[model samples]
Target: MIKKRVLCFSAILSIMVLSKLQSRPQGISIENPYKQIMLEHAARLKEEAKSPRNNSKAYFSSLTFAEASVPTEDVKVKSKLSQYLAKFSFKKVRSHEMHNRADKYLPKIAKILKSYGIPEDFKYIPIVESGLDPRVSSHKGAGGYWQFMPTTARLYGLKVNGNVDERKDFIKSTHAAARYLKSLYEEFGDWTLVAAAYNVGGGSLKSSIRNQKKDDYYKLRLNGETASYVYKIISVKEVIENPRMYGYKI
Candidate 1:
């Protein structure tokens, strides 16, 4: 009697599980939330892939900033960029807000950057730095539109004292940022490396280059953030410049 009861309970449990499985949608499971999210994302992407405006070639080609190009052709770089592209693959309400704020300044910033002899694309630095937010301050003592550290601000001829912080002054700080980025470009002779220096500090990048005997930004054994710094900027540039290509409505 005990054996019969146990067998019957096992049979009933198996039947319920089989029924649940049969009732579940084809090739979809409720077990893993992460997988479910990815599947949903893939479905969205499949829909977007049908759009004729989706241009992967043009998007990949724009990865080159100044004379230096991201090695998006490399398997690792391609994979990494795909990861960022996925992360950036979102509706652009936030980006539209930033872009609306950016419009008033980007033309001026572009002119300033051009006059300063830096690539106009470099103007995106401040976008990545503070999203055109003149009031943003980092925990690392960086502040203002360009996100200058107090010392770096002063070094670039911006006043950052208690009485008045010129780092918060849009025009002054943009000029300072242009000067600083130019100086870094002069030091590195590569805009990509200059960008890395801008993010991770010239000293650290210099040391990495010296020790590694490899000036290539992609080759250096950098801190994780620094390693992917230029890639982040490139990713932002890709999305911002071609929102439609990335499936962003804004």
Candidate 2:
């Protein structure tokens, strides 16, 4: 009689447990906890976007100028950047043209610079040098993307003879430019100075820095082109990187 009572009680307990489980909501689940988080994110996406909270600061946040000299705040630098922003870069035709040309050459130049442990941002040097045009020639005989003179080209292991000027060869010229930039980096230990030295030669930049005794690119009394060289680079960097900010379509 006692055993029979115990059996009956066990059966009653199992039925009660089943009934409690069945009473719970039908579709709720704990299988994937991330489901709740993802649903919250989906709701957020449905909300409207807001404009930049601080437009001026936010616009410049895209530009770091990392591993290069001339901060965005410097007067001369800003002046040059402003010049491009106001005129050529913001004008859709011009901005589109330079960027379209840049697309072909910057990748190879950036890769070569990286291989030599140089800053990849130095790729913009070509945009400053020749607007990424391999066939361009300056009044002073500087040629190719990096605008190396024949002597400098030869020195950097590029053949610059009548039959073959390797400076015109994008692949070889990028390598030569990397080598030349590495040497400049060694001389000045500053990428901005390296770029300046590239434009006016290392000896000239060294002399200017010594004469000025300022050891600052902004203060060094350079020729108009060289004085404006780094600022131009920074300017191009700003506009090219932030085309939309300058009102460029692409």
Candidate 3:
């Protein structure tokens, strides 16, 4: 009777070990079937969650621009600019003709901006403003990449006459732009605001600054065009330095 009882106990223990081994994978040695099953279930659930959801209601339907959420302060303007940069690609104007033109103009602009302690990035202002085409004149009488109106040009010491519009002279106009930029920086103490004020006048920018109670360009309420102006300059700077990164082949 004692031998039979011992035999039964040994057989039951062997069955329990076999059952545990069967519940595990071929290469694994999991002792708990419940834990192994739970881990497999979790993995499958993760894959399901990663699968694309086709329901349109799950995401935003309307088109939204980055600036929509930005506050009306100069700093916010810079921050929003960093966000806006991801959406658009840049184009490199590397045509032989354009490069030739840029060669003639970029040096002088760089020299003047350097003299003023402005960033080397300022050299591209003409690329956006005038495409290095001195003969190019805006309908509003703003000319050159530094794009100065007759009144502003004169204020910056660039002569605008019928025979000789100094606005078309790269060297003279850039000098004027440097002087004007320096003055704007002096008044606002911020490069972002100075860049914006270049598009609009300093007086208008200062009024906006005071009314907004913050120096942040992004946080301040501004006209749509002017709001984008400073960011456009930053975008231009980024693209010019590494056009390929912005997806411009040139």
By TM-score, the best candidate is 1
Question: lDDT of candidate 2 vs native?
Answer: 0.75
lDDT of 1 by residue, 1-250 (tens): 9999999999999999999978876554455776888999999999877753355555565577665667766777877777766555446456766656667888888898888999877877887788888888888889999999999999999998889999889889989999999999889988888988999999989999999999888778899888877777777776767667666562
On a 0 to 100 scale, what is the lDDT of residue 47 in model 2?
39
Q: What is the C-alpha RMSD of each candidate to the true structure, in Å?
A: 9.3, 14.3, 12.3
Local error of candidate 2 at 159, Å? 0.7
| Model 1 error, position 96 (Å) | 2.4
- Which residue pairs of candidate 2 clash? none
Question: Which scores better on TM-score, 1 or 2?
Answer: 1
lDDT of 2 by residue, 113-169 (tens): 899988877888877788777888999898887788999999989998879888878
The best-first sequence of candidates by TM-score reads 1, 2, 3
Residue 213 of model 3, lDDT score: 86
Model 2: how far residue 88 lies from native, Å: 4.1
